[model samples]
Target: MVEEKEKREDLPPVNFSMFILSLNTSALVHLGELPDPHSQQKKKDLALARQTIDILDMLKEKTRGNLTREEEKLLDTILYELRMIYLRVSGGK
Candidate 1:
């Protein structure tokens, strides 16, 4: 039983939003280029942007006054841009 408990603890946490946030943060850090850059870098940025939207979808359920006003607004802007990027990537009308 003790071994089982330890194993469970080693598993990823149940907070999907937090997981997504972590992924987004990592992607953003590695996403070199913005506002104008090489094609390859732009591709990376687009991928990160889509990932960020997915993160926002998860965050929508988790954020509830846990963030400051500025933080929330920042998240909102990220979500908006991500959605736009995702739409474009998906070939939106």
Candidate 2:
């Protein structure tokens, strides 16, 4: 059972921080901040960035009262920074 849980997603040791990092990476890519590894060019996609931010907000809402103090803090911080970046990138659109 433990092994199954660990290997369920083939993700290798998933954690809250990893989830946040994944979302951050997506948002950065959408904001044209992260260069594509293959093409080495930034791609700006505001719609996708908004979607990613919404997903993070959903996680924050759904996990309320279920996360550790540090997890909550980290989530909030990540969301805030991402929101700010999204706004800046989209010109408050």
Backbone collision count in every prediction? 0, 0
- Each model's lDDT comes to 0.58, 0.87
Model 1, global lDDT: 0.58
The 10-residue segment of model 2 with minimum total lDDT is 5-14
Q: Could you give the C-alpha RMSD of every candidate to the true structure, in order shown?
A: 8.7, 4.9
Q: Write the per-residue lDDT of candidate 1 for residues 1-93, one digit (tens) a residue.
A: 999999999987765345545655544543432422233343345565556566676676588578767666666766676566456555762
- The sequence of per-residue lDDT tens digits that candidate 2 reaches over residues 6-66 is 7787875679878877888888888898986678899998998889989989999999999
Q: Which regions in candidate 1 have their CA more than 4 angstroms from the true location?
A: 1-52
Worst 10 residues of 1 by lDDT: 32-41
User: What TM-score, computed on C-alpha atoms, does each candidate reach?
Assistant: 0.46, 0.81
Name the best candidate (by TM-score): 2
